[model samples]
Each structure stands twice: as structure tokens, then as C-alpha cells.
Target: MEKLLVVEDDIGIQKQLKWTLDDYDVVFAGDKSSAISSLRRFTPKVVTLDLGLPPDAENASEGLATLQEILSLDPSCKVIVITGNEDNLNALEAIKLGAHDFYQKPINDEELTVIINRAFFVSSIETENAKREALECEDTPIIGTSPKIMRVKSMIDKVAPTELTTLLLGESGTGKDLIAREIHQKSRRNTKPFVAINCASIPENLLESELFGYEKGAFTGAQKTTPGKIECANGGTLFLDEIGDMPYPLQAKILRFLQDKVVERVGGRTQIPVDIKIVCATNQNLREMVLEKTFREDLFYRISEIVIDIPPLRERNEDVLILSRMLLNQCADMLSKKFTGFSDEAMAALMAHSWPGNIRELQNKIRSAAVMSDTKLISVMDLGLDDTHDELDFSLKVTREKAEKEAVSKALAYCDGNVSNTAKYLGITRPTLYHAS
Candidate 1:
């Protein structure tokens, strides 16, 4: 049985509450001072606080002070405020001051029971999540030592504690999703759900309903009522990946939801309020798209209150080698292989190659090499880089730059110096190709 501190000045009401909540190790308090004492002694996860206590029995001053004290002691505590029938204003004020929920003075045993049970269930979930976070700290998936990565780590530390909407800008496979999860895990909302949706992956027709949910029989296939990702992530995070690819029409609805913190299900008239931290990721150049009128500029600004630009592996300097080794070790353990490390030639090849696909590409290459390696050390041949390494310059910078330059030069010749055609053939932006040239 979990401890529950009930703070009520009325003896009759206190007795009724204790009897009703007999399942819990219920402790009673008559005033603000006694409530604080009971809170320190029992450290209850849930507290049913009355709005009128002792010397100020006719007013809500004492109860409000107690609520503040309880929250200051343990922010996670779910304090349910008990108020008189005419004290609706006071109850609302208590909610603003961090009371989890409020009950009217003439309490129905069944109704109060349901609310307390919900608080207990929510408290249990939060406790489990806190433990899981601690375990995650013991072994993290993020592996890097580069200055760029270090800066990202520092930024995560600073930004995660706040409730700002964050935008992760990076090339595909550069671990944007991983960083989003890291932010969620480090936030106060970690104990709640972390719902992720790739705006680019779902069809435009279904994306709206997927986000805002739908009423029963809202559509032909709507079998039952469903709460969408936004509602499901009510107290946690909603990660919108590839937000640039989100359909232009749906962007307005999303913007509306973000602005109001409320959403109405498809075919539903009721607006359901939700509380969540929004984190969005995109690979596209949003500012350029805004200028081209392909994306909503206002929505872009709304989601990008805090932008974190994650450089590609090519720009990450030596993080490639560091990530490669870590991935190799992870693969070895999973596959039950005896791989110690990579060979000198393998390391050279890894350093030389331009990882255009970034972390995802590197992971795939390492997994393949780990499985193919015959000796304890993984070699360049095992990684399928033997033939390519010979063509690489390995002089000024990575061989990928050399490859890019050669491809661009040939494309330019083939296109007869036409920038557009050259860029098209090389599958790069004109600005990118011009910079390369």
C-alpha cells in the first residue's frame, strides 16, 4: 500500500476520507503546519488538500500556501485540491498553482476514489520512468568525442530543462532522431509518453487524423474513437520528424494546435486540450522553401523556437572514427563475435571515405564488416572498401571531397558548363556544386 497524506481541518471529513481511502496508508493533517509535517514524515506521492484550513477556515490562503510548500518539496507529488461548491474560482487558482486536480466539498466517495486511483497509477508510471532514465545514464547509445558532438551534448544539457519547442536541422541519417530522444529523456516530461511521428512518411490524407485523432465513425474506416499522437503524448513529448515534408494544407492545422495547445478530432466539435513538449526535425532548407512558398513561414517560426543544427558526418571531423568503433563493439556483442578492433588500413579507409549517408550508413558498413571479418581485427577488405581506398587521395581532406570534385568536373564537361544540368547529374544543389568547384 502506498502512502497518501490527506490534509483537511474538518474531523468528520477527515474520518470519511480515511475510511474511503483505507486501501492506502492514509495519514491525516488538520492544518498547513501539520500537513507539512505529515508530508516530510511519509513523503506521499499523492495528497488530497483542502482549500480551507484552521485560522483561515473561511478563506483559501492557508491551503494555497500548503500546496506551494508541498510542490516545492516534491514537484512530482500529485496534490488534489478539495474545495467548496461555491469555491470554483479558488479551485481554478489552486490548479494554476500546481494542484493535480480538484474535488468539490460535497465529495462523492466513488468519484474521489476514481481520481485517487488515477493519481496512484500516474505516480507509479513516473517512478518507473525515473528508474529507466537512471538505467539509461548507465549506458547511453550516443557515442562521440568530437568537438561538434561535444557542443551538441552541451546544448542538450542547457535546452532539455526548458519547455521550448526545438527544431533539429541535419542531413538524413545524421542521428537527428537520436538527439530528439535524448532531449525528451533529459526533460521533466521524461516520465510521460514520448510519441514520435514522421510527418513525411504518412500519407497526407491520414496525417491530420493521425495527429488530432478522430471521433467514432468519423470516416468510412473509422471503427472506433481514437486519441491521436498529440493527445497520447499529453504530458510528454511529440517528435515530428521531416517536418519540412509535412503537407502544406495540414501545416495550418498543426500551427493552430501549437498556438492554442488544443486539438479537435476529425468530425468532432469538441476541442481537447493537451500539454506536450514539441520537437521537430528536418533535412530540407526551410528558409529557402519559405521563400519559394512551398512551406508555411509562420509554422516554421512556431516550431523553431530553438534550432539545433547537427552537422553531417563529413563535417563532424573525427567523430566518424569514434562512432565506427563504438558501433563495431555494439555489433560484436550482439552477434557474439570476438572482434577486438579495426586494422590500421581499415581505420585509414574509414577516415578517407566521405560518409554522405552519415551515422546510418556507417552503422550498416560496420555491421556488414563485423559479420564478414575472419580475424579478430576488422580489415578494409571486410568493410568492402579495398578497391575504393586505392582511388582515394587521403591527402588534404577526406577522399569523399576528391570524389565530389571529380564527379562535379565530369558532370560539368558532360553538361557543356550548364550549372543546372551539372548539378542535376551530380545530384547536388547548384550552390553546393559551385562551392565544390
Candidate 2:
């Protein structure tokens, strides 16, 4: 249920109001202490607050105090102040102090319901916008000049000209965002802002304001009017990252925006139209999110208007060496080091190693090696792969035996065959020495 808290000192009015909003999970607070207790305890996203309380019902002082406390405790809480119908100025002051909006006394059940429902609706939209941004931020720049990398680039060059809402599917750290930006940069919208937001990182409560903006006094703490990311990126591309994590309700709103090219601000009455190219990226199976009711089928169709699935690092082995060199150069330049190259053994290790972490892992390892290596060229030891040399350094069992025999023979030659001393010095028993000979 959508949680809501109604704080008023009048017992009859409180009980009657609670019954009216039976659709919501309602919590009532008769006094300031109880109200704050409920606030911190539940952290309700939307609050219905009376501006007149026990200590100062004739004035708004007590109610204003409660508003300030709510904002201080949770700056994002949407507190709708309840004031006497004649107290317009007090309501405006409360707005400045961060009240979401105000509802006058002698409440009209229908109008109050509209305000509360708007809060819940707007709060839901904000959540989905944040998750969309999270999906976007996880991408990176695909750095390489290999034939395979070049082929991927070729596809990007070709497809970027269209108005398709490209969906880039790849593992984390594979530079999906980089490719997304590249497509946006190459497209007709190159000059416009390439606004990117991660969907998963932002909380659902504030995500709406971040995307659709809100009217001044839309709720307590919505002090001044502000435009969301969507308005900020009017003519540019709005890249929604991790689109799958977007809450279901928001998916519907986004689909609405996609269809009508218009958005309504949180607690807003009129629709705000926006024009921009939309590009989304995600690693999750959105098809499954839709199946489980977590993702919207309509939005999946809206964003996946075009899909570009980039191959993972292991699948594109041909680009490994090329990507490594480029990434190493980036490290060298960033670290201000002149790394000559990798040692022969180091090169072999780099090629042989199974890089499960993809380009990002290799980049970090090489960057570290470049900073720590003593020689101009980094060695296998520098990359922490010296154990890999074991097989390559050994030829056969005879080689091991001959090497041991030569060592014992040399010691004997030096000591003129002092058997007891030689055995003791070599830290070996006589039986072992006899077997070696």
C-alpha cells in the first residue's frame, strides 16, 4: 500500500479524514511528538500535515515547526500542509520553508484525495527515472583498433543516423555507454546535450523531480521550481541507463511520453512536451522483467526500437592484444610513464591469460604494472604471472635430474669428494646422494 501520514490535533476531524482515505495505508499523528515518531519510523514519502496543532492551533507556529522538522529529518518527504482556508500567507510561508503543498481546513474529501493521489503518482515516476539513469552510467568507452573492434564501430557508424531508440546489451564494463555516446555524437543530435542518468542509483522518491521536475509548492520542501533532467536535455539525447530497473508505473509514463512527446511535472496540471532522441542500455533481460511484472512491456517495446548487442571481451579475442596496447598507452599517458613494452614472457602471459574481467580488468592490471615496473619494459613478474613460466622453463625430467647431478658433481669437485661433508653441506642424506649419482 502507498504509505501516508495525517497529523492533526482534532480527534473527530482526524478519525473522519482517515476513513475518507481508506485506499491508502494511513497513519495518524494527533500531536507533534507522535507525528515525528511516525515520520522517522515509517519515513512515509507523502504526508498530510495540519498547520494548527495543540500548542498553537490558532497560529501556524506549531505546524510550521512540524514542517521544518519533517524536512530536516528527510529533505525528500512530500509534506502537504493543512491550513485554515483564510491562511493563504501562512501556507505560502510554509512552502518557502519546504512544504510540498497546502490543503485548506474544512477539507473537501474529493480535492484532498486528488492532491494525495498526485503525490503518490509523481513519486512513482521519479523512481523509474532514477533506475533508468543507473542503467546508463554503467557503460564505458570501447577503446581498440582491432579488426573486430573496427567491425563493431562500422555497425555503430551505420545505425547511428536513424531515430531508433538504440538498446545496447553487453556485460558490465564493456564500454556500452561509450558506444552509446559515440552513436549519439555521430547522429543528427550530436550538437545537443547527451544527458545520461543511471536508473538504479536514485531512490524512487526523488527520481520524479530529477526527471519530470515539480511545481513550486508541489509538496513540502519543494521550495523553488525546478526542471528535471528531461527538460534539461530538451534538444539532446536522453540516455536511460539500466532501463530494466525502472519501476512499472514509470514505464507507463515513459511510454506515454514516447507516444505523445509530452511529460507532466510532478504535481503539475499541464503536460510539458519534450523532443529528444532516446538511447537506452541495460545488461538485464528486460523480457524477463516484463514477464515478472517488474518491467513494462510497452516500455520494452518503446526503448528496444532498435537493439545493438555488443560482443563480450572473451568472444572477441582478436581485439584483446590491440585493446591491451591502447589501454596500456592510456595508462602510460595518465601516469606520465614511458613504458617501452612488455617482455616476451609478459606478452605471452597477456595473450594466454583468460581475462574474465574484460578490458576494464586488463586496463587496471597493466596500469598497475606500468607504475611498479623497474625496467622500461614490464616483465611477467611485473604482471604477477611468474608461476606461468614453470612449464615453459622446464624441458624434461632428465633436465631436472641432470641439473641436480651437475650441482652435486660441482660441489664434490670443489670438496675433492668429501662424501660425509658433501652430503651434510648439500643438506641431503647419503642414501639420497647415492640414488642421485
Candidate 3:
């Protein structure tokens, strides 16, 4: 059963609430001290706090202090402040201090139950979105050097030094997030936090709180004050991936923050100043979305200050075999396979196929091939590329160059592009690999 806490100072009302709320696993406290104590012990998702407590029953000072303390302890707790009919001003102040909702004197059991249920529902949604974001942030770095990808690297180098809002445009699985991380790593605030949020993964209702955070008692279940992504990324970079999927209602708030560099948490009257560099990425065309009235024009122009277009793997033909060799070696080591290299037909197959999922798809295929291959060399059939035709020549110089390039590429990839380790792996000096490339 869902847990609920009732913080009523009145003996009669406390008993009445306990009777009406029998469906919940209810805990009770008659004063501010006991209420806070119960809050810590039970950690209930919902709390009904009475703004009139002992020693200040006629005033809201003690009750308000308890509310603040509860929120300080657990920002995610939902707090419903119960107040007298004449204490409307105090109730409003409680809300401003982060109380989720307030009920007047002589609370109707049915109405209050409805509000509590809604609070639980909203909290559940926010919690799920938080989990999704956690999963999305566990991503690897970008790995490629096609001329198209080289151009993107050049663009990142050029833009990383600036405070200009950057927008990364690419298809899904094309490493937009990795590029975002690269930008954050290269920027002046590299030492600070690099907070990233996937706009598409979070629910629309919860996105606002997740972005801007919430004050204690901000909503039904908010028990404490917690900083949001924007606040967490203060003095650093805020990467909003899948920016095109952000809800239209939220566009105005984002645009406002971009303009003012300030954020006001939910149920908060004070504006917190935040100094953050904004980086956004999206697979969809925001310009087209803007034309279609789906995306905001001002927000689009603001975020796309220096847009970097990342070309997909299918378009970067030269990068295929190089990346494949790198991924092949990586998979071989990870899977404990003694695969020496890809066969001639395998190379042709790697070059021939159009990778719809880009580098991500390539990595998966190579990993699968490495595990499935029985021979020392990965065959075309092992790579699931039997239909592809062999286009490579069988000349001595050409064969030698291909072998050298593949070995060097694999070594460099495994060593995370370290020159010394790559040279050591190939049993040669840095200059030799440098000259070959």
C-alpha cells in the first residue's frame, strides 16, 4: 500500500483523517516535531501538514518552519498543507515555500483523497523519466576519422572555445551525444559538470521539473528542495539531446532561460542565476519544424547559433573499412577471439553495405562477426555480407597497404587513438604509422 503521513495538531481531526484514509498505510503526528520525525522515519510519498502547530497554533511560524525542514530532508516528498479558512495568506505563503497544495479548515475527506492520488501519479511519472535519463547518459565516446567526420571534428574544435549555443544535427545513432560530450570536454568549463538530458525520453508533464528542479512542497509529493538539470549544470554545459522532441509548452521557458540565464524552480518565487553553456542535438530538422509551427522560431535560432551537421556512415564511404577494422579488433579482444583480420571478401562486403544505423550498427555487426567467426580471419559470410561483390584488387602493394592500414587502424582504435601504443602494437615507430596514414 502507498504510504501517507497526516500531520494534524487537532486530536479530533487526526482521528477523523486516519479513519477516512484507512486505505493507505497511514502514519500520524500531532505537532511539527513529531511530523518531521515521522517524515524521516517513514519517508512517506505523501504528507498532510497542518500549518497550525503547538506553541504557534494561532500563527504559521512553527508550521512553516516544519514544512521547510521536511522539504530540506526530502524534496521528492509530496506535502499537502492543511490550514484554517482564515489562514489563506499563510496557505499561499506555504505554497511559495514549496508546499504542494493547501486545504481549508474542515477538510472534505473525498476531495483531499483525489489530490493525494494525483500527487502519487505525478511522482511515479517523474521517477520513471529520471530512470530513462540515467540509462541514456551511459554512452561511449565517438570513434571515426572519415573526411566527413574529420570536418565535424574541425567544426567542434572551432566552436568549443566559444560560449555560443551550439546545435548538432544528425540522424539517430550518428553519435550526436558523443559530439555533445566532446564539445563539453573541450570548452573552458570542462572541469565543471557536463549535464545532459534527452528531451525525447522524458515525459512532457515531468520535463519542466526535471529541467528546472522543484522547491520543497512544490507539488503533492515534493518533500525537499532539489536542483534540476539547469541548476546542476550551472557554471558548466547543458546538453539537450533530441531537442526537437521537447514539448511546445516548454519552448517558451527554455527560450526565456536562454535570454535571461536564470531559472525559477517550481513553487519558487526567487529566480536563481545560472551560468551555463547550452548545447543541443536533434535528428529532426528544426527549421522544418519551425515552418510547420511545431518548433519555436526564436528558440531554433537561439540554439542553432553554430549548427554542426554530422554526416551519417553511409555517406562517409572512406570511413567504413577503417571503422570496421577498428570495431573488429575491439570485438575480437572483448570476445576473446583470436581473429587476425577481415578476409578480402569481408573487406569488400564491409565497403559495399550501406549502414543505416551508422557506427552503432557497424559496431554491433563487427561484435557479432567476431564471436561467430570460427576461422582466424573474419569472412564475408561471418559478417552477414555474402551478397556483396569483391571490388578490391589483388596487387602486392595494394594488399600490403590495406593490411598495414587495417593493423594501424585497429591498434589506434584499441588504444583510444594513442600514437605511442598504436606504434608499439605494430612493432614500429610513430613516424612510420604517421607516414603511412
Candidate 4:
């Protein structure tokens, strides 16, 4: 169990905090001496230090001393100082003394809980990242020595620093969205929000409202005013996934909005100006769509100022093995399962197979293997792939799975009153069921 050390001078408040942090194994202390002793005993990852302790219950002198000592002992510990409503001075002092944060007294239990929970969540992420680094010498989203993936990574390193409108083209599951996120995280707007919307997912009627927001009286369901992802991500990055699916009419409006950094909400006459970078991704062939008059050439030019084409997984030579190992670890973490890795046969099969569905198919197969593998190591059979099957077998297998049951029932009914077997006549299942109730 995780430990929480609560140091408060008042016995009543100490008991209250002890019960408040009941989810954790909480330790309580009354004064500086008791607080130090508890800290030494618990070595807690999280500690709540009240600003007023004994001998200094009306002041922060002794409380500051306790904070310093806890830091000197365990610098990694998250020390959250409990402060008075108007005690900003001591809070600042505590912050300068390395306190993670200060919570005002007479706190809303929910707000305090959110703060504590977020602190712990961040702490856990950092701890996991550290462990990952220790196990592997490096960390990067794009992994491989393949020329295609390598070029994409090199482009990200260069383009990520700029505020350019980038359009990523690839097949589905080719990591287009991941590349967009990499651009956001590595860009000058790294600290800002990275908003993503799927153009294909939202209906054309609602896509306008989703991109430009709506006023209270915009539509029948518009109960209140709301900002869309584009406006919400102002001063950040807005990623439009499946840009090819964007309707033809809406494309004109989006083009105007991109040309001028302003948008008019649905059902409202006012124009709101916003500043944001755009990153668009699609699994469709935009050039072909342009030739077919489905996609707008003007809008295409606007988004594809800097285009990056990502290759499908089948073309990336050694990336299959690298991606598999990385995917294996991620699957293990999410499922909370201990999967050492895939079998040698599985790795070879994955490497040789043509990933027509690309990275997304690989991801699904890994997830299936992780959940269904009979042992710690997964095999090619677990992937449910038929690499060696001919076209005839493939067609036969699909037909049997889909239509066999229906055909069998029809045959049995037509052969009514026959006391012997049916599949012995049909030859579908092993040890066929005998006929006649």
C-alpha cells in the first residue's frame, strides 16, 4: 500500500486528515518532532505538512524547518504544504524550499482530492518513464532503420521546430496521427494543447458546428454557447484527422477560415479571430480525389504547404521487429500482463508478411496475441494469419465459416425423419450430430 504522512498540530484536524486520506495507509503526527519521526519511519512518497506546528502553531518558523528536513532526507518526496487562507507568504517560502505545492485550508474536499490524485498520476508516469529508460537506452516514437521511417523522423526533427501547416498522407494505421502529435510535442507550441478531430467520424451537418462552434440559438439542440476544437486550440495546434472525408461544401468554409484567422459560429453573425497551427492527416489518395473532383484543389494547396508521405509497414524492412517489441511492451503495460515477447517464428512471420492494413493491423494483431497467447511468448498462429494459404483455400474457408451453419440446418430439415447423421452426409463438422430429435 502507498503511504501518506499527514503532519498537523491540532489533534482534531490530524484525525480529520487521517480519515480523509483513508484510501492510503496514512500516518499522523502532531508537531515538528513527531513529523520528523514519522517521515523517517514512513519514507512516504507523498507528505502533507501543515504550516503551523507546535511551538510555532501561530507561525511558520518550525513548519519551514520540518519541510527543509524532509527535503534533505528524501528530495524525491512530494511535500504538499497545508497553508492558511491568506498565508501566501509562507506558501511562497515553502515553494522556494522545494514544496511541490500548497493547499489552502478550508479546502473543498473534491478540489484537494483532484490535486493529490494528479500529483500521484504525474509521479507514476515519471517513475514508469524512468524504468523504461533504464531498460532501453533510448526513447523515440518512430523506431527503425528503414529508409522511409527514417526520412519521416528526419523530417519531423526539422519541421517540428517550425509553425508550418503540415499535411501527412498515408494508409490507415500508418501512424499519421502519431506523426502529427510528434510535431505538436516537438514544436514551439509544445506546452500548448494538441487538439484532434476526425472529419470522417462527424456528420457533414454537424461538422461545421464542431469546427466553428455554436451560439445558444444556433440550432434546436444548441442549449448553450460552446467553443469548437479549432477555437479552443487557439495559440496551439489543431489536427484534423481523415481530412479526405471532409465534405466538399465545408471545405470552402474551412479554406476561408484558414486564409483569414477568423471564424463565425453557427447561427451567429459575429466573426471571432483565432491563431492556431493546422496539421491534417488522411489515409486517402488526395491527388486521385482531386482529379476525380471530390476534394477541392484550393483547400488541398492550403493544407499541403509542407506534405510528408509515410510508407506502409510492409515496405519498412527491419521496422517490423522493432515495432513488435515496442508494441509488446505497451500491450503488457495496458493489460497489466507479463508477456516476455513473441516467439522467434512469430517475429519472422510478422517480418515477412505484407502489412496491407499497415501499422494499425500490426497493433491489432499484437493486442490479440497479448490477450490470447498460451504462454509468455506469442506465436504466428495466435495472429490468425494465413500467409501460406492459396486463393482457393482462402475462399473456401471464408464460405464455410459464414454459410455452413445455414446450409447444414436446411439439409437436415429437408431430410426430416432420417434417424442417421446429417454432416456425415454433408461432411462439415467432426463426428457429425445424429439426426431425429
Full-model lDDT for every candidate: 0.88, 0.80, 0.86, 0.83
Best candidate, lDDT-wise? 1
Which ten contiguous residues of candidate 2 have the minimum total lDDT? Answer: 389-398
List, residue by residue over 223-326, the lDDT tens digit for candidate 1: 99999999999999999999999999999999999999999999899999999999999999999999999999999899999999898898875667767877
lDDT over C-alpha atoms for residue 318 of model 2: 50
Clashes of each: 0, 25, 13, 0
- Which stretches in model 3 have alpha-carbon errors above 4 Å? 1-142, 389-437
Candidate 4 local lDDT, 358-412, one digit each (tens): 9889989999888888788888888776656332232423554446566667777
Candidate 3 residues 149-255, lDDT tens each? 76887898899999999999999889888899999898899999999999999999899999999999999899999899999999999999999999999999999
Task: Give the lowest summed-lDDT range of ten residues in model 1.
Answer: 391-400
Predicted candidate 2 versus true structure: per-residue lDDT over 126-177, tens digit per residue: 7646544543462425554445665777778887898877888877767778
Q: Name the lDDT of candidate 4.
A: 0.83
What TM-score does each of the candidates earn?
Answer: 0.58, 0.55, 0.57, 0.57
Poorly placed runs, candidate 4 (over 4 Å): 1-139, 387-437
Per-residue error (Å), model 1, residue 277: 0.2
Tell me how candidate 1 scores on lDDT. 0.88
